[model samples]
Target: MSRRNVYLDLIPPRQAVQRACDALNRKELVQTETIPTHEAAGRTLATSVTARCSSPTFHSAAMDGVAVRAADTFAAREDAPLELQKGRDYDPVNTGNPLPEGRDAVIMIENVLQVDDSTIRIEAPAFPWNHVRRIGEDIVATELLLPQGRVLSAYDVGALLAAGIWEIQVLERLRMTFIPTGDEVLDFSQRPTPQPGQVIESNSQVFASLARSWNAIPSRTATIPDDAAALTQAVRDALASDAHIVVVGAGSSAGSRDYTKAVFEQVGTLLCHGINVMPGKPTLLAEAQGKLLVGAPGYPVSAVICFEDVLAPIAAYLSRRDAPQRRSLPVQLIRRTPSRLGQEEVVRLAVGEVRGRFLAAPLSRGAGMITTLTEAQAVTRIPTSVDGVEAGKTVTAELLVPEAELSRVLIHVGSHDNTLDLLADALMGLEVPLRLTSSHVGSMGGLTAVKNGTALFAGAHLFDPETRDFNFPFLRRYLPNLAVQVVNLAIRHQGLIVPRGNPKGIQGVSDLTRKDIRFINRQRGAGTRILLDHHLEVEGVDFEQVRGYEHEEFTHMAVAVNVLTGAADCGLGIRAAAEALDLDFVPLARERYDLIFPAEHAEDFRLQALLALIGTEAFKQRINNLGGYETTLTGQTMHPGQGLE
Candidate 1:
């Protein structure tokens, strides 16, 4: 082959994966080989597997007992145990043992103890399948076994061999070579005390592991010194070996001694260098005499990023390996983040429950920061042509983990509840990861979210001095025709949440009117804001006279956050949100925070789920444990107009 033919058509990871797949099409399996059914785990099926004989080939004992006809033990009971002649009326057999012909059921061995010579009695009647394995019970002949391209399991091998089948055809494994390069870097085994400007080498190990996990054989995983000559020799050795894909860890940069691109250019052909991506900007693609080559970064995080986002995808397609399904989710960005207009940026974030809102905190965006990935729950890709993304902007996140786990989460909008954390832990213990997205706008914010259909449900408590009613009035006023089922998640004391002790002589809503007091106010559209406005008009205090009234937050926890941070002198929220941050609460009035669901969505899965949560004795007990919460109306669906509005 000519030297020019040995060049990779360097492109984005998305394109590279596609290119490899196009180059290597799916091959049909026609050959079959004999393999021990037990050891053939994770091997793909070259051809369709079909059972030659029926499973449970004959009627067999399903339990360790005596085989007897159903009629024989029909009236057998404790007082009048029916006796039967051993071997004639009933034959004893162990579990999975073949039952003698004509037997319909088997009495448990415990029921038929050793009685007088060749005779036994059973106390209970046997039902079908209770103690018998019938013919073809497990499977039938000519049933499909493994489909083509399926990775074989140990159980599949057993089934194949049990069906009297021999070796089956499977796809060929991919051979990959990992080449680590850097002058200052040391091998994984070498505990080197490096001089200034030196760093420990770890990228090759990650590269190899990543490659092997994707069904690619790491035939040449090694850390090579950064000499163009040494790299040339290593590349020669790798190409000479059986490696189909050679990945160079680091050294793709255009800097001096960045010999990956240069070496590949000399040995084969350099298709392209650099993709418009953060951290992985210096990515390189090459082909050496028909073998694909990938050049990744030296940083451990960047190296792994490049592997999965770039090479492994191609390797999977090329090897005919099934590509794992990637799911995208619609998540609202917590705050504005900047990105280059023409360069795509992959940002990592730590998703967490703050109050009842799902708040995603941006992780360290440094290219070399491994902690960015360690702390991140997911990665969001910002496309080129968009310079920046605003806070609260909805963007699609490509999930590395399963999306079902995220969907099962309970999105709560309210003031922060530490109790929600407890609930989160309980749910997680049950293998259900409950995402408690707390947007702490306080009790009022939660109701507004329910009214707007912007959230699943909200946690709220608002004290109305006039009507002396709870959420019913607000629901009636704002969300008309909203089929609202008010399930009381909590009922906490409403009041002025102050610092440790009231340093200032502050009491009730009147103290917030003081000129020196810088008050933190909940944002407009929040139920808390409505209640605050109601109090302001009744108290005859001008909001313009108050400082920090225009300052806004989306949740109670956020208000507490600002107050705790000294950003505001005081704020009005639930006692829980206040106490959580060690602030003091002056009891104003008790209020109910109920979860409201739309009438049309009354039987929706989310509402059904909320009903189950409220109905549980454990949840009821928890609501009671939270000091002021009244569980009388808890789980009760207060019909529309029964509560507010």
Candidate 2:
């Protein structure tokens, strides 16, 4: 609970994590075999699995339709409809049906009208290869169904059976056993829950689940008494069993009750302990008689971290398998965060949409707090060398979700606009997953992203007095050749976000020039920034003459946080951010916020999601709730030459 702690020497994030991994003996273990293809769903492949035969060996129909030779229907015209009788002219077939000999095209049942006596009339000429599924269209016979070391998917199972491969070579699953050793630890099974200091042992569950997710079987998770004798007995039992990997939970630290190191050294060679990572530093790795033992920390995130840091790799080595879990990305920080100099910090984050952009909000982290990880989408690492990442600084993060998610996300990197969430949520059940990653820079920043091709689209509200418009002039000047369809996200009022009840006694953008005022500004090139700058120029106010002009954050929430914490007097953002934080809003300018994307990206599957949201009444309802927003341009597309500013 002490906010005051002495500074500790730090180390690079990568080196600390790597040293922890390097200590384990992973290069020598390999246990593998072959199994039935049907049972390979959760198993990793030990060797390449080539297809025994091609899928869809013959030409077949992809849909239920009448198949006819292209040459037979080539001369058919709409006015003079061609009549075909089944059993003579063509064969009626259903989906997945093999194409009959001499047939090269298909006319959908709906495309042809049925007449009297088994005859059908075609209104148009069907193309030569229309609706025809060619031989080996899906896959070629004797081809690779799965490559060596490939983890099998659901589709892979179906393909394996289709290819006539009954069995497949898979890495033998790594069998792990977890032994929880801590005097304070209590099992979670059938519990009313432990009161305060009494621990509910659940790190084993995390390890077991993660192990299962990686195609490894967790054999037994036993809660051993805290004493060294009891711990030693448990370790012997695990070694006696068929387990290939052993995880000793909780007791790896140098504390008296923590006998994992002692027990490991008594029976096996201790590899290393105390990795340079926060929360899960007391990790132990050992090897004994061809078996690997990993002693993970008791803290939930720490347990999960050690599971990923230590156990995952050992399991991979034992099975001769590598499971690709979720993916990762490098993103700019929304706020400043510090870390210990000698240890790596794995900070969890809840990624959210802000101003047509994606921003990661750091979560409350403690080794004992599992809820933080539960709310997190990814883990951002801070190196030991620095206390934390400064606001607007970029850092790498490993996603706990899927990488395909990145494709589903329409990354917006500017201006706080609420319409984006509306646009995204409207894409529910869409063919492609739709998400919005909005980074709240100002309108100008968004335009720059569009210009730099760093964003799919930005929500911009830049205004031009000369042309009496919003966005078009800037887009034309900055993003020339960027053929974009500017669809209005919303028409919102530009304003100053202040603490509740207007404690700052500030009104209008001119107050920003006040010497006593400390301000949080939107990032440079952001739409909000452009709006602020334009207002300043029109009012003849020099931004450099203002106080705290250099202070900036990536999202409205971060900006609001600055105001709430007294770091700044106010910031330029949407009214929603102010209202959400129970803050005050001072209207300055009204501008149209539209999505700006590369013209070529107009058809990106992800943007369809934004369009869906814009078109929905429900999305409109949400936007209506956010004060100072107008939804008229919600779904309408504005082309390059259009004059709407």
Candidate 3:
């Protein structure tokens, strides 16, 4: 049997961080260097900075006026004006000009009446030291300007220059070197197309970008294979360099091919091998040659959590700066999300302001799905003690985007459609862009979200076999009290997506009874599933006879991908999905897809803009260009009992 590395006792994220902190001696590991004060912005000070020279070394004029002694101008009054020669009683001065030797006050140019070239008259008495900047007024010589361990800002640079401090001693930026290790990883710099088992290497660049944001110097070595000796040498080399931290990407799990843990043990003391957090459990931490070594998981989301939560804090400690924190807000969850009991799961959310409160919908939890993070505006953590969070429950969420952006987010919880993507893109082209963040929970789930007041709007295409009507029938039954307005987005075709060549010879719904035909299905509440059941009944085919009927996908695109990848022979989905993946489609029915909005939110500016946008000829044209949609009712509002016509 090939030897595999076992994880150390799984500890909480905070405890693992504390162990790394206590093991490393910052004073010995990090050093200070002198650099120009102007170039020290964003750097932490190694020592306290004092002013060498006071601001305004000499008494100077604060305004453009005439410098004068207060005693000489005491006799001047508004009722009795007095005149004096410029050189004898006052000296002309502009802002910042040095005050004359005996002058104790400044008279405004507007207050003086110029009678001649060298003389002026004043009507008001000048007060002593009025509008005069005395020596050391802004800053005093030998006074503390900045304290040690303070992170410098651009304003701090200006203060340093004004206080006559030419140079500053700042803690050296923490240097980080990333080593990507895996035979299955390909360097993204080459732009190589990944084969089945190969994945493009991008975690290193992700870490590098994050490192820069933390004021750390980041470098990356070329990808190294999964050989134990090779990885050990790479870590040793990284340690030998000036790098304070070495991160080995991938090969950190308990798989037989994973060699990072073994390499960490060979060259250093393994402080932690796993963390009690989902998506980031395989994080490895070790100390070698008085430097930090990390083994990061290959999964994109897992790697981000490791970099942000684990490594970022340690880096902040070394750099003598406070770790960055995101703003948090309370949000209402739109759907029940389940999680395991042992680990804390980071659930990314599509958060937006609906009515006056924040509503959040959980995105995908796949550790390898990087798009989830990109699309999320906030994230909430599910506690280890809880099994899941129920719908309509309020939880505190850490914001991933600016708080102001929440209002501009248009939350749509509903069925998945390609036309919605077109609408999303068009909404962004408005003068004030609106972000359309959607959660595909099926049409029925959308109605539930609307009923709970968790979504700004929803997309649904529910069909009633008895009434031969769409969403109206379902709304009348499921939500009798809530008032809503429906608008037709488009009329779309639903069909069975097969391989490009239709290898399975699947012709119609009756073929589902054939043992050789494998089918993919949508989730229970999805409108597509209802359509499929209707067709199965009309064909007199038993649902139990269909192979892979229980296999469910959330979106039309997901269903198309199953067929594209040969996981299923065919799946019932929208025509756009089949066209997108270059698959063959067998048309089944044409359905009216509509947007459902709460009656109270009908006048909301975001909703109004959406309504106006879809009504435009250009937008209707775009829908027609999609090849599988009818634009006859593209942007018209619907009344009860209006079916297809």
Candidate 4:
């Protein structure tokens, strides 16, 4: 094989997508198939479908009543009732039952008095066609039931079946075959416990699911190693099969091990080797052996971006359907987001509505962070010409969740606590579900978010050494003018989290300065970090004495995990976090954690529901079970002027 292509010839994402779509159209990839209409929901129609027969084939009764000739009861009145003999003047009929011969109307059973088995009396006149279902009322014979190119819905299936359409001609489902490559990739089907340097193959599964969502049939082949001959053979085999598109996972970059472009060249023509998009820049597109071939990056997030931006349009075109439109809404960005000037960036956003305005917080931008994709509620695109978006700027965000769900999201920005995850779960369990979206930017960061009007509330546990109090001292200094209600969420144990059995024999704060020990610290503004500083001051330990002090994580769970995984000897966090990971804990202090709510929003219905839930016995029990929380003051409220002494 020739040397790997050094230059990618990157093009804008739109141009790359259009090139794939144009190739699909030029090759006439779309085809049609006939299937039972009962199985046609979500499939696009190939041709206009017309009714073979009218619904309610014959005049049928619309209610459980007695069918009669309207002329027989025309003179009836409430004062003087009219009597008629059964079989001669009336016949019993149930809803959807065909009316007897010559019957033109129906009198509800409740409206008629049964005098005997053979007779009945009516108190009111029955008008012509009263409560009668007319022929062709719902559908007329030979009328159009669905237009060409229409996508079938569940209700459409019922309508088609009712109109005597047993089979329908629909656009054929686009068949996509995904081949994951790389010697380091392990098949998860074997349930293998991976050692170092081996990554479980998952990107192909992600592609398969995404393809299914776009109404395409997806099949994944066994994992292929990085050998060029094997990969070429797999691609050629896929092309020979019934696949309309073949996606090769990973090995798309310019690395010496990357051979996707070479394989494509051997089989057919390489259309484009790269796209100028963040996360998905290494995307490759090609047309070979009458099928489109795509090279998706190994990173999970990048793989998703490539599938959606490059392959989705081609699949839609081949399936004879329009591409799905993402719902876009204007949202206020919580912080300044930087992006490369020449590449179009897709920023995943954790979006929620606060104070009648939608606020979007961008998630981590790492291409391999799959959690960002799962947790993101929406994504905002930064055009290639722009450098980035500034804080407090408005941008259009494409929603991953329904737009209506944004109204139900409670925006919590501040210190990270494991209890917040439990609270989020509880809130979603309510009859009218509420979702909590929290950003772990530390206590001070959370307060800033509230002050900026981008958050409904903030989780804070700021410790003030001078006054020896929690939250209020810092709130007064930072948000003195903003009227707020501080509600205690928990009084949780703050301590040193060490590995199981305390293998390092870490005792207390002074031990953090020991030359042999490595410590993990929380982010600077985090409440746990503030507490750590207080202990270090009292112990007279210089910050420089502690090894790995600069290394930080945003959440207690993350800090504890680092210790559990042997990355650190100890870290300061809550006992709940230590207990969760089976780590040993050295007791330090118990501090108050509170939720700071804007005073004006105290009575907001959603906030009220959240507060009530916090005070519930079930919520308190859950906190107690976490093994480090005190619930006696869980929901107590304090005003701005009130100080904790």
Candidate 5:
């Protein structure tokens, strides 16, 4: 066994970017070329553009009327009308028409009365240069039309054409090549179904798309294996070509197989090894042949942060354009987000405008989960000095989506169910589409979020064995004073999810204690966990006797996955979850799953739309279609004493 290369002294991402920017000489690396003016939109100017010819080189008509010498119409008046001969006294012109020779003014057609084919009568006097576009009025010959380094827009194209600029000198679009590495990475172009321990390589495509958005040229080479010599050759080849930046995706960490640092050191000057950020800490920066070389982490989120925080700035500098910035807004945190003391953390948030204010719920923080980026409407940063942001505290968030879309987001801070997924899709089908963003933090967490006024609504299914009820008992115990409206989403069956064909022949809770039957459980404070405990008590099984009881998952689907993957023999979850993955289900108790909304937000349009959609028979039928769900009490208001009525 050989020791791997450790990271150099960690630096702030901004400082690393500045160091790269200071090292790369853009004038020597980035070339400029002449391109057609019409094809130069979104391209940066290499030098100031001067007009080749004056706009309206000759005096032209600015209005549709008659052109005549001012002295010819000076004596005309309302009381004494004057007659003029066509061509000699005046000439008819339309907008943008060139003025005839000797014409100094224009008599509007509305004021001129036609007497005959050769003559017309006029009552108003014409003034010099009236309704005329004078030469050099807009653009003067040899005048600066656009400044150097200006990013050309569509309007700039039209201006350039009018100024007689047929071609322009622009800085070349930055070229980047991404090389994906790893033996476990399957080529996405082949669309190969991934077996265990294999993953489809997609970070190259992500980087390519992001580079395109930055107006830079992006290409990818075939996947490279975890060979240091091969990676070094790839980097040298990219540098030998015209690529301004070279990126080696994955294998940048401290693992034995991670060879990016070694390859970078072999071919280039290592400017940075690690960043002082959470998801993007493994970022590497180096200069190879006066060009930027970036070693991005393997995780999707970390790669995105590396590209956005480090590569984007250097790219903008190379092309002489400002980096793109996202819109930002202050949003109240719906949950407590903890972070370490040293590294800055980026937290993705599901943000929505609720009750005339913006509310944000933190999504999953896993760097490998790209869905967090798709689901997040915004992202906030926890500074390196701070430990974390507390619930109900406001933080300024950089928006991933448009600000207007925030009002259409419906935030759910608790309990995961298959019905919620269906509801989310159904909401999007409405006349005014609404996006449902849910955070599965258990039933108790839902009540806590509602009490904190962080969520617009929450889903709950808390069961009370003493009262023989669900949700209401816990609501009274936890939230005694806050007024809320409870609406039943469905009465769902909860059961033990087992592998296909029930290889373990697990019957029910009685089988849970068997040494052969390793049971997976839900997290504490989860309604499903409570239900499992109640069943274990009834079956005379002690809590400590159940194997894998403490191996907890957060959602029903996750629990079912544990069973399906052979990690456990059986786990308790909703039948829908088992049915979803084609697993066997053992019948058990059924309970109500309800949506809780604060009474004050009863009139909110988003909440009202949800209520209206759920009340319809169509939504109920959809619920019934999911299998193992009873919609008899669906969309109806729930009371404390109402138990499965």
Candidate 6:
């Protein structure tokens, strides 16, 4: 049999998901288990529960009063009173107590005048059945209390107990066994420092958390190698246990070492190999040994998406529960997002309310970018029919964070800087926590976000060769009409980061022309790239002379990583980045990094708090400790076109 390329055979997410549900339904995976009613909250009822006996089995008092016959109070009036003998026409009763055999009504104690212990007087008539709880009023014996498929709640538990029910039949919680497979994956439980080519096994843990959140019981097996026999044995072992579902992590792709699909085919029937969803395209679904089997992609984000879109629904179906709803809000897109014509895409977004409108800025779309998942507040789904959504288009975004928290977010879109991370941490530690969501698309991209009112502030370090100044010149040129406040964040050291001991002996920008030394460059529109260009021009050096000048990284830390991993001989970045990677740095120049905000947002609470924190002695002390930052002018605000003295 010829194996088809799964990517070419991609199916719509809706169809792919329905296939899994169909398999479970055909197999009759739904099973019932008996559990105590008190512990059944959030579990679905597998059997219709009926009242064992009527609540308040006999006529009972609804209040603390005297139970009496209505005939005894017939002559009672405000002007003419009547008395009733205890144990004959009236009896003392508390709330929920059964009424006396001869009593037909209850007169509240306040209305009864206690003349003596054996007698009581009333100036008002007692109406029939008044303040009296009749038999079968709450629930009738053998009547349905909860229907099959009803999810139990706290109030439901009370009703069950009142009907004399101690245990109930509920759909069993879906049990999932996740097996992580990879030769390069290391066990984080042992606290092993992975050598090169080794990654910490964490996708199983991510899957476990997601399963638990969906009310399923999850257990992770020990890591297995990429051998097909080992994976086949593991799946067989899981199928032999009580687990209703088995998930194999990290071998679903078409790589040579990928054996999840082959193993699933050997053990059972492969339902579908790939779905037309980005990041989670390699998801695999199968049925084996009268159980469900799933293959999750290795990437953390892909694994999470598979669990949510495919595995979660199957679990919900087996438990006879509806899938959890995703909260969505309509948000304006900050930029155009392109997608394949036939494939649906899930874009993670950093969402915030700016100028009375919700703006969603897209995060990194890389399947391996787990940080994007952590920082995202919402995600926008693009259906498979459209090419893409244009900028400024109103799109419905499913919220990850609560909608209320978006108002408190400080959106920063700009050039990447390490200090921003520090600032985010400090802001969250405040009395009222504040979230800072930043998108690093370079300095120019940030300025554009601010111009469009999509960001609260932007970090800029733009350099002008003619004026020999930073930031202000470009602000005047681009945002001529908009008033902006440029506040100094720090003056950081920018230079070439090389391996320790200066193996390449790359002294300055001119040395980049040497054919032997490979250089890593920042992405276009980045302030660092602009700075590099200006220096290269001044030194009369053409960029083409530099080897690997077009190899781009998005952040200083990325550049440092490239140098540390021997991917490049050197890269231009901040001194702090080199120090972090234990690499040597060659001093080049000091540049001002400023936070640029619209004048209208100068007094915004979050921005104001950030400014106040920046000026504090403690904050300054921390910046100084970072080794390359100078805090002399930190927190000072300036207007556009202001001189940089």
**Which candidate ranks first by TM-score, i.e. highest?**
3
Q: How far is candidate 6 from the true structure (C-alpha RMSD, Å)?
A: 2.9
Ranking by lDDT: 3, 5, 4, 6, 2, 1
Off by over 4 Å in 6: 1-8, 25-28, 63-94, 100-126, 639-645
Question: What root-mean-square deviation over C-alphas does model 2 reach?
Answer: 12.8
Candidate 5: list runs displaced more than 4 Å: 71-89, 107-126
TM-score of 6: 0.92
Better of 3 and 6 by TM-score: 3
TM-score, every prediction:
0.55, 0.54, 0.97, 0.85, 0.95, 0.92
lDDT of 3 by residue, 516-631 (tens): 88899999899999999998988888999989889999999999999998899999999989999899999999999999999999889999999999999999999888778898
Please list the residue runs of candidate 2 whose C-alpha ends up more than 4 Å from where it truly belongs after superposition. 1-30, 33-35, 57-95, 98-135, 190-197, 316-336, 349-365, 374-378, 389-645
Q: How accurate is candidate 2 locally (lDDT)?
A: 0.73
Per-residue C-alpha lDDT of model 5 across residues 510-552, encoded as one tens digit per residue = 8877888798989887888889899999999998899999899
Q: What is the C-alpha RMSD of each candidate to the true structure, in Å?
A: 12.3, 12.8, 1.6, 4.1, 2.1, 2.9
lDDT to native, each model: 0.68, 0.73, 0.92, 0.89, 0.91, 0.89
| Candidate 1 positional error at 97, Å | 2.1
| lDDT for predicted candidate 6 compared with the true structure | 0.89
Off-target runs (Cα >4 Å) in candidate 1 are 1-11, 24-35, 50-54, 64-94, 104-131, 139-144, 164-169, 219-227, 269-272, 325-332, 398-645
Expressed as tens digits, the lDDT of each residue in 1-645 for candidate 2 is 212211132233234344434554444444577788888886777777777777678888877889998778867788989988887888888888989988888889888888976898897888877898887787787776678767688888998888888988776777789887776788788583776567887887887788887777785555788777888888988888888778898877766567787778888876667677887787777777667777788878888877886566556555556634556777666656778775778898756433445556566677888978865667887877787777667777788766555455556666766556555566645666565555565677677666765566777777777777778888878777777777877777668998888876889888888888888887777667667778888889998977877887767777888998778889888787787788889988777777776767756666665676577777776888977787776767765444443
* Clashes found in each candidate (C-alpha, N, C closer than 3 A): 37, 36, 1, 0, 0, 0
Candidate 4 stretches with Cα past 4 Å from truth are: 1-7, 25-30, 54-147, 501-505, 508-517, 638-645
Worst 10 residues of 6 by lDDT: 1-10
Rate residue 261 of model 2 by lDDT. Answer: 78
**In lDDT terms, how accurate is model 4?**
0.89
